[model samples]
Target chain A: MADARRYCTLPSPFPMKRGGALHGARVAYETWGTLNAARDNAILVLTGLSPSAHMMSGAEDPSPGWWEGMAGPGKAIDTDRWFVICVNSLGSDKGSTCPASTNPATGEAYRLDFPELSLEDVANAAHVVVRELGIARLACLVGCSMGGMAALAYMLLHPDTVRAHVSVDTAPQAQPFAIAIRSLQREAIRLDPQWANGGYDIHGDGERYPDMGMSIARKLGVITYRSAMEWNGRFARIRLDAEQREEQPFGFEFQVESYLEGHARRFVRSFDPNSYLYLSRASDWFDIAEYGGGSVMEGLKRIRIERALVIGVSTDILFPLEQQEQIAAGLEAAGANVDFVALDSPQGHDAFLVDIENYSRAIGGFLAKL
Target chain B: MADARRYCTLPSPFPMKRGGALHGARVAYETWGTLNAARDNAILVLTGLSPSAHMMSGAEDPSPGWWEGMAGPGKAIDTDRWFVICVNSLGSDKGSTCPASTNPATGEAYRLDFPELSLEDVANAAHVVVRELGIARLACLVGCSMGGMAALAYMLLHPDTVRAHVSVDTAPQAQPFAIAIRSLQREAIRLDPQWANGGYDIHGDGERYPDMGMSIARKLGVITYRSAMEWNGRFARIRLDAEQREEQPFGFEFQVESYLEGHARRFVRSFDPNSYLYLSRASDWFDIAEYGGGSVMEGLKRIRIERALVIGVSTDILFPLEQQEQIAAGLEAAGANVDFVALDSPQGHDAFLVDIENYSRAIGGFLAKL
Candidate 1:
């Protein structure tokens, strides 16, 4: 596979949001299409928690990316007429300076020793990459899921950097339900003896990995990522064939259980557990209220943009549609032209990734007018 | 504490629904009010997964039972006019023959050696107690949550035994979403190194218990048992005081997290993990469709109850209002006068337990008319 990623070194002794600083850190990013001479057609894309910088297939790397359905030459995020840059999150394992990265001082993985991560820190790191790419200002900024939270921080910290904004399935802050789910996910990993207090062998066989903990965490995540409605329509109460079930008690019996098991197994060994812990906690800690005198709407009003489109799915329990409406109302109160669209997508918070048709229509229409 | 519970030894070699049989098994029960001369005023109460036979406090045991608010002298299921019998489930550790009970053949705890449990088994065992009490027929049968599933199996397996039925928040079969949640809960318990393949030291101290795994599982349960709306209204984005947080990386921070931890800690050592696993899986494996030629509606049609009252909460994501409506429609089609009441309670699936006002009104009204 051709290499599609580019790295930009962050300022040494980069200040973190909570505490401490990184002596030497870098960010990885990928871009599609060409940047105009005016540097005004650049659209910087921020991703959810787990995705890499590669958002779509391109000449540099032909492998299909996570958001391949929504971003391409003529897709919703049409690269044919715009420049798009997707940045890997700062606390992710996908070619970024994360907890899995080596610490210059100790010559070992930072692990839990990494400074507390915040959306502000992620925004700052992504901003460094944007500056290095010679883009003085972005024409549009698209943030999806966790990326939406980071995007809010980005605009609040670096005023006037973005002209247009598209917030997809994100909240002004972490709600109690979201916080509870994340806390349990973190507990699942920490309870595993194999985790060894974030000191598990990073380069070892399955025996040394926190496989069970990570699998349980990932399974919990997959359950909440999609809506119950979608699960009802898809798997229903379907049972697995007797031949497919394990002989032991409490083993996989239902198709839904099998599906969750498959997802967990595929994800368990891929992501770094420490990086996951950091990112998950950072998401819970982020609240726009911190910036707005304990008011989410007030904090949202702090972001000044020319135009905004806030899209949410009705079935999204993680970040309900009301949060998206609040964003639109807050942005509109700030004098930005805001278009709020609530789509009846059964895909829940993951609608932006799977309900391409509905998302493309709302997003494409918003960008076209912009 | 007084010994309010009564025991009735089931017929020796009590055959189970799935395949195995239990010898010298006994069921625990408690009764309020008095059996009428005609034995026609008897009301059999079936409980959820975890409750004991003690549904409410009485003269013998002046302690608050699980449904203290709804059952007593003049409460919803008024004991003044009806004989209310609460039976502990067959596979529960609460004063019943379960995985925690001794295996007479081996003189050891059943543990994983317990026979595969089904709701049918629970209903049959409860029926044995009712029959031993000299009740030829019941005036009404009340089932809540998991108990409701057992009630369905009860009425289907033994026709004409129950004249009226009250089905609380439950489903005809486990949906994929509920199955997924329960599957993860079971996995959490089994993954604990201390589980020791269901041979963990039941009588040992905290060091020998599957404390971490049970805590995680209970936390997950608490998360699902309540609604997100309730969490938003109750805890919102409230953070815990620094003094309350543990001085570790991923320690409790949010008030909701703290609340879940409190609940988990309180429940971790109280229930037997092996029994929990059996009952949870039994819930997953239950389906009314299994008896009605693969049609849930047809299965409902087979039950010969005269009148039925189905109660569900609007905010309940576990059972949902649609399932209640399905039960009502199916029973109505079967010539029974069914009253379906959907209460707009924010308490979710647990509303039947906490939203006492609404539940009392609906339940009291139904029984009064009878």
Candidate 2:
């Protein structure tokens, strides 16, 4: 039951999907449990926009991962029987090559000069990491939200690498409404004077980042990530305490406003503004149809997986249930065995992160079948 | 038949619901058709957050209002037979006593010093305008969105000002979800460096009006105002042309992004940022329960109107269908004849504006019975 965080370096001049190359490219990952002699009981877990490689807590880390409840011993993922590998997304700021990383060519941070990222690039990087770990094929690949897009890309790029796939709360391509929301987020970062046209040296100069813009962007993101029904049921126009309201300069009166602002503040501390811009834009540009000559069915057919399970939250306004239905329909049309599960959860796109029992039942059932 | 925009001056020292009187308060209004001899055929119209008093085309102003199709001759409110009056809500920037207007006391713009506005204040101001016009309301009161909130307030305050009420796409009070969105909107403007803490003058320095923040706020607003179903159906994943994308500094690729940006730009130019802050806050503070000392049912009991029509759009995430249902149920419990119509529209909160024929049919049918 060894658990450790590790890194895998790609060969120099790694090719990217959007006609660019990266030098000294590496991916940081964390693994739990021992690899069996056959190396066949491995599972790869991809993350949403802002997670680190720390997918679950272990004896070494003692700190919870984003999917704290679903990936432990005897949990839905069952690290006891399965070796779990979680990779930090390539364009993220968490111990991976990103806008915050130094450029091999310039000897300085890449900043905006970082090569344009595509979901395919993130998937390819993860695949290279998997091969570096001496695993030939995974038993399953599990992804949620943006991670779902990356998992799909991985299946498309390296067909037959995994026996099963689970994509939760995601779409084949970013819908127009989602894209519009992301565009505004990018604009919020770009408009901030503190961003300085994406050249702010947050680490070196100890200068403040675009805190206001990024916080606002994150607030907007929180609104979209959760369901209105959830907020109404949870907050319900309750006023904040006078002391708390007094501390806020903007007269934050409502409890819901306080909740949004608190989350935004925490996000601004953890996330790099440039990394957010690149990853958000990358998700917007990702279209599965582009890989299959303008047909999602054709693209899905390229994946060599035997079985797929897709889960969608009914209240998810960001990636609605219809999007998951599309994924299931496309996979079924492509001659793959697909199980699509729609859960009625008030948590919206965040149900995968919050509704542990529902997701555990679905994922555990699918894994048991595998 | 004459249609012209007009104005009415309220007697000095107009008192507001939240306290603090406004001196030399005035209201701008527009009228369609001649008043009947008995003054019993006058229908008063209230506007949403951003509309002017001009609710329809007129002799002097041929340009159409927000409800152009529904208020003309032989239409919903039938200007041919009923004298229709639309008042610019108090605190609006369109020819009304808004933050941009001169303060009689200080001889400068009221700005944030403008008395705290409530839906009741807006309703009261409109009532004063109606009385100054020598009209004893008889026909009905029609309001949509914020206007609907104001109409409800008017019915509660005056109680017998109108015989029938038509509230479209609005709730009795702003829900927690709506308030959270609006709080973010206000924070966007407040955080902008250009806003100068609500002191930016459009007429004087002209350069420091928080244009970027307001634009972004308006863009977020437009997204909530419409439905995801409508955006998906209309825009899908269509990319903007190279020429159009070139115009955006943030690399706007989707047509929906361009659409939101365009609408936001227009709104930033036409709307006063402070007015948005005030009116949005007012809506959040509006609670029918507060009027009746903590019971919405008791509040509804105060309205003397015998009949009412309440319409809700199924896709309206802002003013959800359940809120309108509550409005109808409350009115019915209070012994009033109420017709509740839930429309399956993809336009969301803006359905009352875009789905003109459906709204017209409902309102016309109700008016005809009256």
Candidate 3:
């Protein structure tokens, strides 16, 4: 029972959908359990905006995964019966060929010259990783948020690669509201004087990264990821220091403020600002209808999956429940067996990550049917 | 018949509700129509976070007001019949005693040295101007957003200052969700290197203001001010340029991004960052319950208005409809004639500013009954 994180390089001159090519592109992935002799018991797990290939515990790296609750030996994903593979997204900085990666042509960091990335490219890169692993098909494909968009793109591009698909808390296309939020995030990073036009030394001297701008962007991201009801119920205007009610010019007083700042501070340390900008733009530019020559239903018709599951959180303002409903409707119209579940969770877009019990039940039940 | 914008300096040593005093403090105001011989037909209108005392077209400065649709002659507020007085909120940069004002003690700009401000202080400052004008009582007090909070404070503090009260798009207390948003806005300004700890020379040459930080904050403010449904309906993932689809490192390619950036750019030129910081904190610290033994009902019991109207928009995520309901319930419990109108508006908290027709009808009808 060996669980190891591994890396594999794709074929030389890997082309991107959005007019770019990587000479030496590599993908990082983690695997659990053993692939059956038929290689039909493999499951691929794709992640949201900020997750690595570590979906669960591994022998080499035993640190907990982002979705550790769902992918253990007898958990929702059931590693005891099925093999699971989690691949880091193509343009992400975490062990992937991203802005932080070295360019083969110049022998320097890609920085701002990493080439344009699209959701389709992330999907194709993951597909190549699966093929390189000698798996002709997967038992199921699970994705969340940006990963959800990538999964759908993969289903459309490589229709026969995956037998089942599960997309949670995502939209077929980026809505104006969601795009506007991401656009501001990019602006925050761009406007920072220290960013140096996205050419700053990310790991060098004084103020190497745009930490202030990225921190504010992450703070705004946290607000959008969670519902107001959840914040109200949890924080409720409680002061961080009840004893020190005297006003200060600039200070973190409210519990919600402290919560957001703490999260943002931690994120600024781990994420690359350039990679964040590229991946966020990829999500915004993703439109399934565009791939199908202008109809989402036609796009769904291209995905030849046996079964599909779409889950949405009721209070998710970022993706909204209506988007999931549309996804389910599109899959149903495509003649695929679709199971749609709407969870009434106040965690909003992050409900898929926060409410583990409910998500595990939904994912477990959906996988049980197969 | 003259509609004139005017200024009045309060007597020396003006005390604040909080422990601070302002010397040579003045309030800028605009008056529409002549006060009746009895002076009982005067209607005092209060503004939101970013508006001045120009409710309608004035003789000296004939620019249309922010609420020009509802405050014109024979309009909802009916300047032809009822004289209207629009006072600039204290601590606002729009011709009020704010961070930009000169300190009588040091003979320099107050900057961050400006004493802490609260909603009660704004209400009290406005009340002094009303009293200085020799008006014993106001026919009505109409407020929107932050102005609504001030109006509630005025009603509680002054009790019999106004005969009728109309609050729109505001809550009696600052909720944790709203506080978190404001806290982030303040943090954005503080983290900017150019801010110089709120001592930036806003009028100095060569990028004196913290434009980038303030712009991002304003952009975030704009998003929260409007509803997601409104943004989706207006600009749903439209490209700014069809030909420039090829990705650039830092570029504005979405229509929503253009809209937000344009708004942010304009806001940076007009708004002072220190003023924004102070006023935003004022809104966050505002809690009507704090004034009345930790009970909002107890606070509302002190307001002795003859009639009250609380208007809320259904899609207003910042100030939800339930807060307005609570306001109405408190007023009803206090034995006042309360009119609670909940509008199904996609404009969110900005419905009071954007959907003028609905607001006009509601406010006009409520005033007509009085």
Cα lDDT listed for each candidate: 0.91, 0.87, 0.87
Error of 1 at B300 (Å): 0.6
Query: What would the per-residue lDDT of candidate 2 be over residues B1-370, giving only the tens digit for each residue?
Result: 4546677787778898889988888889998898988998889988999999988897878887888988888898888888888999999988888888899888999888898888899999999988887877657888889999999899888866788889899998888889988898988999899888887865633787798889888998999999989988899889988887755345788899889988987788688888888998999988898877887777776777889999999999889999899889888887789999999988989988899989889999999998
lDDT of 3 by residue, B1-370 (tens): 4446577787678777668788899888888878999999989988898888987785666777889888877899998888889999888888888888899899999998888888888888889889988999999999899999999999888878899999999999999889988988888888788888877875634576787778888888999999889988898877777675425566878888888877887788687788888789889988888866988777777778889989999989889999999899988888899999999989999999889999999999999998
Q: How well is each residue in A1-370 modelled by candidate 2, as lDDT tens digits?
A: 4546788897789888888888998889999988899999999998999999999999888788899999889999999999999999998988889988999999998888888899899999999988988998999999889999999999888877989998889989998888988998999889888888887765734665788889889998999899889987899879998887845335799899889989997888688889899999989988898878988767776777888899999999889899899899888887779999999989888999999999999999899899
Residue B266 displacement (Å), model 1: 1.3
Fnat of candidates, each listed: 0.94, 0.71, 0.81
Model 2 alpha-carbon drift over 4 Å, by segment: A1-3, A247-250, B1-3, B247-249
User: Which model is ahead, 2 or 3, in terms of lDDT?
Assistant: 2
**Clash number by candidate, in order:** 0, 0, 0
lDDT for residue B362 in candidate 2, whole number 0-100 = 93
Count of clashing pairs, candidate 3:
0
Docking verdict class for candidate 3: medium
Residue-wise lDDT of candidate 3 within A97-195, one digit each (tens)?
998899999999998889989999899989998998899999999989999999999988897898888999999999988998898888788878778
Task: Score candidate 2 by lDDT.
Answer: 0.87
Instruction: Write down the lDDT that model 1 would get.
Output: 0.91
Per TM-score, the best of the predicted structures is 1
Residue B320 lDDT, candidate 3, scale 0-100: 94
